[model samples]
Target: MKGLVCKVCGYVALDGNKEICPICYAKNVFEEREDAYKMPDFKAPSGETEKKHIPDFTVVEKCGLIPGTGCVDVHVKIGEVLHPALSEHHIQEITFYIDNKFISNVMLTSSINPAAVIHLKGGTKGKVQVIETCNLHGKWFNEIEIK
Candidate 1:
């Protein structure tokens, strides 16, 4: 589903129809929500530049983790296109949330690639949300269900 995202607060509209931001209450400050799952080419065939700061959380290991076994490693990276970690424009941070609870946050700069493999405890079976913020662009989020 696509909707307008608030530029100030990174709040995604409940539906694409909303013209006002629910969180920041800002008007006329919404941009179309880009689907991070489907990555656009770094340079489109039409000669347009595509942004690739969208975050995608992928379960590297099997999601149905056995309790008391070990930690589950989740690989966080750009969906398909690699994001340029340049000094002028780059991703600032990546935050992890499990079942709506904060888990970990990784601070990044332009020198390093905006990718990380984070390990989470294997006991809880729920949703894993990954939110990444770009210095130029706002925040982008994606999730995966872990069993």
Candidate 2:
């Protein structure tokens, strides 16, 4: 993943361009990152390290909390093996994107589980991407198609 990252707050701009850092509100502090995120290699089997860093998704077509709202529930977990949540090393945040466009983000602490659920608009269909940043592992992302 080639993108622009905020030098101050590590906010990634997947489009490879950003004038200001969205997280830190810093201008002219964005730098190009050749490996902004880590994606699972489909051709190779994932090891324990990959399982601990890669994000997982579970999509529900209907919103259980708000029925009749026509919202799609997207559940995101940090990893299949469940990464450790310690004061030193933990999942810092999880970001949502639809077709490479920004949607929402969830900031986390070590006290809680590294997971989040975002509700999308009705009839939203595209490549739903989830990116999670670990304090030790940097960043990892996974995508799923919804129709």
Candidate 3:
């Protein structure tokens, strides 16, 4: 299993040739034999995702305050707004709460975006927990957050 990486996970595929990573199978795997880089037409930004504004989309990150205390960030649409100060030409909000207590709100605007919020923050939490994200629809296509 030395060079074995999950086709869908990019992690060492412990079980071999499977579309899913043994580790992420239950939580992130969509189907067997799926490519990590390949996204279905429905999930990608092709149809309704591009034209409409998905609301209340959130990403939750966890920390030490709770065993799984997390923070939530978002991916929203800019629709038709322009701001030189913002980088991605789009705007998103982050509704943050920890241990069930309301915290401060923040904004995320960037030109360079990477990883599915689920993929990037999926397993990022650790012992005593640090960060966990729960995105409503931004996983593979379109979503928004308003904090």
Candidate 4:
């Protein structure tokens, strides 16, 4: 009946300090506290530069991502804009097949758009195989390679 009281978790305290009471520990009162939450200094403490980009090895171009299967969710950039004749939506199935064995097909790029970026199955983080392709007249060209 003296200090502030927790409305959400129903935690009552006579004195409100920097530390939170045990009853409302699960609510993480410190992070949501108006008085406690202060704007931290944006500058790094010493020599902290930009964080390195950790690639998802599992969903890269090198590793082929199977459809309908759970794989690493990643974004793949395949092929360049080669055909001005084909507008935006024209890519159907720009894939390559040899010997009827299906050596390698289109993993990302499609005719609807210039590039085909899809989420892999693994959904973890690793290198995946992506084939770059382009649509010319009617034939699809697979050129770029990534992993």
Candidate 5:
């Protein structure tokens, strides 16, 4: 089976029955990632190193609570420190998933910022996952519980 990774802490699971990440202690944040091995092997960082390599996604703006109307704007920063977006090494794509289903994807370029602003329809209300792949670092994932 593919390995699992913690979207919050960048913790990787090399074993089976991966339910929760030991480092971050996040349950629903773990997702089965097939390309996780290509990512650099590392442990969760402490307070000062939080922005070292982990992607930090923040909801810059969101839709109203009325449910199903306008669009939801989500901004994803590649990492707390912001990953490099160069021609040699850069993020390839940022994908958005709603309720484990594909919603939209943005193909990134080295010229633009590694961060992405994705617009999702205002109907989904379950789990929102943002997955990105780096040319040199492989794949990373972040999830948000929408209720």
Candidate 6:
């Protein structure tokens, strides 16, 4: 899909316009990418190549870390088969969204695993979207509904 991508951190702006990159905090470094991301065919069986790039989500209705808050915990893991975390090729970052609105971005390095958990405010209800960028594989996307 066409979008504005951050040259430094690979964050994509689906609306095609952003003065600064939300992930990298880079100014005026956005470049238009004709194929910014690839959405896996969830309806069909995934191949080995697809399994290593798609983002996987695990949602908890109630928050575990902070109990009695009614908050939700959205866990995102990059790929069904864990992607490599070497210095040469690793997951650069993972961006979160709720109901088509940007939420947060988690930057990763070679030492850390390609996973993240975002705690949502109480009573949060909407479709949760996740995009993960791999240094060698470009970007991959996935989404889930929280009702």
- The number of the candidate with the highest lDDT is 2
Residues 1-147, candidate 1: write the lDDT tens digits.
355666786655433535676455788887876552233343654122233655656675644455566678889985347777899988777767777555677878988888877777656688877777777765666778888
Worst 10 residues of 3 by lDDT: 126-135
- lDDT of candidate 5 over 65-142, digit per residue (tens): 445565666778777777887899887777676665556667788998887776666654667776676777666666
Looking at candidate 1, the ten consecutive residues that score lowest on lDDT are 42-51
Query: Which segments of candidate 3 are over 4 A away from where they belong?
Result: 1-88, 97-101, 112-147
Q: On residues 101-124, what C-alpha lDDT tens digit does candidate 4 reach at each position?
A: 122234323334434444433433
How many steric overlaps are in each model, in order?
0, 0, 16, 29, 0, 0
| Shift in Å, residue 46, candidate 2 | 0.4
User: Per-residue CA lDDT of candidate 3, range 54-139, in tens?
Assistant: 22233444422334534433332222222122343333433233232223333444543311232123343321101111122221
Residue ranges of candidate 4 with Cα displaced over 4 Å: 1-72, 78-111, 122-125, 137-147
The CA lDDT of each predicted structure is 0.66, 0.86, 0.30, 0.31, 0.64, 0.85
lDDT of 6: 0.85
User: What's the residue-level lDDT of 17 in candidate 5?
Assistant: 36
Q: Is candidate 1 or candidate 6 better by lDDT?
A: 6
Q: Which stretches of candidate 1 lie over 4 Å from their true place?
A: 1-51, 62-68
Cα error, residue 110 of model 2, in Å, equals: 0.8
How close to the true structure is residue 95 of candidate 4, measured as C-alpha lDDT? 29
Maximum-TM-score candidate: 2
TM-score per candidate: 0.60, 0.92, 0.20, 0.25, 0.61, 0.87
Of the pair 1 and 4, which is ahead by TM-score?
A: 1
